[model samples]
Target chain A: MKTKLIITTGAALLFAAGVLANAQRDAIVASLASQAGVSSFNADAGRAMFLGNFTGGKEATPSCTSCHTNNPQAQGRTRVGKVIEPMAVSRNPERFTDPEKVEKWFRRNCTSVLGRECTAEEKGNFLAFMISQ
Target chain B: MKKLTTLVSAAALTVASLPALGASPWMVENNTTKSECSDCHMAYAPGFLPERSWLAIMNNLSDHFGEDASLGDAARQEISNYLVAVAPKELRGVSSIAVPLRITDLRWFRGEHGSRLRNRAENNPNIGTMSNCTGCHRGAERGFFDDD
Candidate 1:
């Protein structure tokens, strides 16, 4: 009887945590969509952007995959060998929770990989893809 | 009498050289500085450079070593203050006019790491760059770097 009660409580807590994380992600995605004047974000489009190679950016970093790796679920390494946490929402629950951090990385990485700031639509799509992962 | 004097002098020399044999440890104390600066690289010990160098580095975060590492105003100010507070007043062989941006550029660093060791770091895939201090010094995060 005690074991059952403990398990039920643990499961409830886990579900609550998941719901909170999802709510945070939804808010961020919604803000991006409003900025882009879009109804919805496409995860497929985001995946393409993540994998696509571009000529405009620095030669060393042609795609997001150059540093983030093709698999968003796996850990990536920086050019200088620093370990980047997994980008998948499932793998890293804290990914993209902060507005400031999301904006900062997008501004820096988009400039490095795409030679420009990511459009609001692109940012939304990227988040959608990671969420799906 | 001559033998006794020589032995005493040798013991004194060993005592004096003890401090020189071990490198001083420098740990990051500020939580903001540790987390923010360590996002891309290790939050390097502020003592590695002087006050002017820290100020210069903090002022140019947007183009930090060719990457845009710009921080919000509040974070930038906090980190800058912490770094300046703990950095050494003077470093050996560094001139007052010099504002070194890279720790590797310091004369002491160059003397400590020779070309042969540098070549190995460049060539080895496991240790891609010399900036990855933990690649060789396993205890780098804990403020230890004596291991060679």
Candidate 2:
């Protein structure tokens, strides 16, 4: 009976941790939505943005998939052969938890890949897609 | 008298071997420099380049080798200071006026890594670029590059 009780408590704690992580992500997404002047983000649009190709940026990196790969759950490689961690929140729980880091990457990568800063709406959609993954 | 002679010879030999022991490993001691500089590539030892080279690189991080590696002002300043403080005043075979940006362009580096090795690195997917020192020198991050 004691072992069963411990297991149940462990599961509950894990669930609570998951909820807390999601809450943080939700707050960040909410703020992004407010900035974007939208009520919700679209995961399909995010996925399309992740896979779309463009010629605005450097010839080497035309799309997010150029480095991040198509599967968000899989590991990615940088242009210089560095290994990037999986982007999926399920695979890497720490992702999208820090708003500063999230914004930093967006500011740099959007300019690099799309040759411009990503819109607040686009950022929200991308985060929503990654969170869903 | 023989004992004294042997001791004197041993001391002389030790003194002679000091220069032959070579320079100490170029380990990055600063936490901020290590973490910030190593985000994209291996954090190269500052000893490989001159202070001016580091200054040039740090000043133009927005176009760091064709990548937008711009950092926050605080981090940028901290890393730049650390690098300049540790970098060599000058390197051999490089002109005083020249500010070499790539370590691979150094004379010592070219002597160590010839075209054959360069081709191998370029051809191999596992070792995509010659800049990826840790690809062959597994202990590069720890300042040990002798394994290769």
Best by DockQ: 2
i-RMS for every candidate: 1.8, 1.3
Worst 10 residues of 2 chain A by lDDT: A54-63
lDDT of model 2 at residue A51? 87
Candidate 2 CAPRI assessment class = acceptable
Off by over 4 Å in 2: A1-13, B1-25
Q: Rate residue A132 of model 1 by lDDT.
A: 96
Q: For candidate 2, lDDT tens digit of each residue in B26-144?
A: 86767778887887788888888889999999998866786677789998888887776667788888899999999888888889999999999988888899888888999988888
Against the native complex, each candidate's DockQ, computed on alpha carbons, is: 0.39, 0.48
What lDDT score is found at residue B125 in candidate 2? Answer: 85
C-alpha positional error of residue A2 in candidate 2 after TM-score superposition, expressed in Å: 7.8
After superposition, which runs of candidate 1 have C-alpha atoms over 4 Å from their true positions? A55-59, B1-25
Most accurate candidate by TM-score: 2
Q: Which residue pairs in model 1 clash with each other?
A: none
